[model samples]
Target: MTEHAPTTYLLAGGGTAGHVNPLLAVADALRAREPEASVLVLGTKEGLEARLVPERGYELLIVDKVPFPRRPNAAAARFPLVWRRAVAQVRRHIRDRDVDVVVGFGGYASAPAYVAARREGIPYVVHEANARPGLANVLGARRAARVGVTFAGTPLRGGEVVGMPLRREIVELDRAALRDEAATTFGLDASRPVLLVFGGSLGARRLNDTLAESWPAIVGAGWQILHAAGERNELVDSAHPDYRIVPYLDRMDLAFALADAVVARSGAATVSELTALGIPAVYVPYAVGNGEQALNAASAVAAGAARLIPDAEFTPDRVRGEVVPLLADPETLGALRAAAEASAPAARAGTAAVVAQIDEALGRSAR
Candidate 1:
């Protein structure tokens, strides 16, 4: 009997944490399962992947960020030349690395990877992390051997709802076990229910403003607040010790453990993590994009796992009227927590599902 060679995987994505995080989760899963497999990451030097991929001990293959043209401008006219060059770069890397399959998380690097992989007669898979698909994944989905979506109702050909692949730390986290430690870290009473408020890494101006103004109300409701107010936020109030305001929390797992509920923007990762952990949330969708943030929070809201507050309606008045009452109501919070757990997809299994798709694609190619 002959020993089959180890499979080589090339994951293409980047430009944002949404793309990078899922890609890394899947890569970590693959590496953990098959220690000898060659895992390569394709991204532009300017993206977070340039630093992150190498730091995670994966081979980094640089690609040009050749964006597709939208309007008929001079840049649009020159797109064909640049796009072809990007595809060529990917093809060269594919050939040199002997890559068996390509996996794409939608980003600037993914379009070229899709084209090159298709042209090279190599199998590829696509994972779209939002309810609304990006242009790169939209084009790539046509010929992809398999496609996965993090949210339901994503309109992609052959798309399957596989949930978002989360980091190992998040996947294996035990909130109950860590509650005491988390409370200690935040300098809060573990016995009291805590509310966590954050808006991405840099923080949301609206969230900070509203929460700062409503801090007294939140504390008076007998809920401790762990607020990540961003590094640049100017809201200062040292008087309220129960309302802990930190610029950032390096250990988010600890924060999550201490949170009975959360109020924040409905970004893909944030929504996924909150639901996966069975924590109820009041999502203030960032009033940007093609309403994708609101769309991302739809399933949770529909299932009674979360509540949606439009950016315009999220204010101190709203927090005092709606949020404070909700925080005070344990029955409602319990129901929301239950719904969140039931609505959440099997997050830890997401990587396995994508890997299964890759295996099926490989099997077809072998035949």
Candidate 2:
């Protein structure tokens, strides 16, 4: 009954919804382009992909793996055995399923997919969303036939700076409807400009505490807040009349779409989505790691998209100084919004070529 050619494509990304959801969006787009193409998700059993991928009506090939431990000694000791087992699982999937293309979307699941794709002599590509590429994606890009980047500054070799792939569902939301919806769904006051605050799932405690301490001033600015305080911050006065605090933003697309101006930590995915939507934000990148968050925010700033306020200066006084000015000046906020682009990640033209490459490689490897 289907008019499209039948093909199998392997979609890989996981650990967090940030990575996994984008992969799902890309795969969904592929289906829209060719309804007959079948998608199999290659993901770690331990990650959210296990729940999310299956929920989207795709078959999930689970692999047992863990990320390369950031901390050493005791954690590092388990790496060798885990690596061996992961490679074995990936090899088995390719051999058994006749997989077509292995696309790496960053994170641990891509590790095994990278190994399996190389071993099978298949065509695999890496889609790096961060300004500074992550470990798994860094290695994966070396052998990838093509590399796709969401940000302009990613160090992916042989990569084209394709904007981050977001879902059509997200892209289609009516902005006014979203803001009005978020006001009710999150129990926020429409009279005040809503400064939607969030830091992904499991939440950010430090951000939560700082927001709680600064809530009075934030309210005094004629602004209401929908803060996603981490679940651990149970003691904070989230139920106050002016504040709408939640454990998570179940509808992030709507939240970001509706927010007037947002305050949050800058993650690569956040930067991509905000840029894609043209949302203005004040970012407090985590004061840790290789300072990638700061680097990521810096790129957005270069584009006039956002402002990075150092975490050290996150006190009420400093927060009010940066925020009140930006909030009061619609001109500045408008500039930030103008930075969001509808075409930063445009690849619809080369999409069929990518899909064909995926199909040929996956089919050959499956053979």
Model 2, CA-based lDDT: 0.74
* Worst lDDT 10-window in candidate 2: 342-351
After superposing candidate 2 on the true structure, give the runs of residues whose Cα lies further than 4 Å from its correct spot.
1-5, 66-84, 235-240, 341-367
lDDT of 2 by residue, 1-367 (tens): 3233476678788988668877887788777866777778899878889898889888899888777877888758988888878888888888787776788888888977988888977678788767788899888888887677766677878777666676665556566766777677777765567788887676766677677677877788778887887676664555577788777776886676558888888887777666656677889988877787887777778777788888887777777777877777878788787774533334222333344445444443211
Superposed by TM-score, candidate 1 places the C-alpha of residue 92 at a distance from the truth, in angstroms, of 0.4
Model 2: per-residue Cα lDDT at residue 342: 32
Which numbered prediction scores highest in TM-score against the true structure? 1
| lDDT of all predictions | 0.90, 0.74
Candidate 1 least-lDDT 10 residues: 358-367
* Number of clashes found in candidate 2: 3
